[model samples]
Target: MRKYGRTDEASSALAVQLRSYPANERTHYKHAVHQHFSHRNEPLTKEDITQALCQLNGQKGGNKS
Candidate 1:
């Protein structure tokens, strides 16, 4: 079983996505990607995901602050 930072529905979805990765790469990938994004230094809130998606689609997210 995999461990996640939170147990809410959104966190569950993230866990499911992580689980889809190959077993050999799962832990390291999750630790590196998720931990970096979710760390307090950057603080990945739900808003960050939305902002990222917008940026990916060529739309600019409003000011970071």
Candidate 2:
């Protein structure tokens, strides 16, 4: 979180997210997301996701694949 200047407010949302994805894919996504967000100067923390979730509620997400 510090890398992107984000702070933790809740539990790890990424941890919960990993539950549904396959192990290998989840691992790759973690690395990919960290690098991607790092490059974009965004965040990938619980607070970030939490806030994003609120803002994105009921909205369909675009595919990143």
Number of the top-ranking candidate, with TM-score as the measure: 2
Off by over 4 Å in 1: 1-7, 41-65
**Per-residue alpha-carbon lDDT of candidate 1 for residues 1-65, written as tens digits (9 for 90 to 100):** 23434336545554565566569855654455454455444334455444434343343336465
Q: Worst lDDT window (10 residues) for model 2?
A: 52-61
Candidate 2 yields a Cα-based lDDT of: 0.51
- Per-candidate TM equals 0.41, 0.48
* lDDT tens per residue, model 2, 1-65: 46744445323575676567668666655554454455545445675554444333334345434
RMSD of each: 8.6, 6.3
Worst 10 residues of 1 by lDDT: 52-61
The global C-alpha lDDT for each of the candidates, from Candidate 1 onward, is 0.48, 0.51
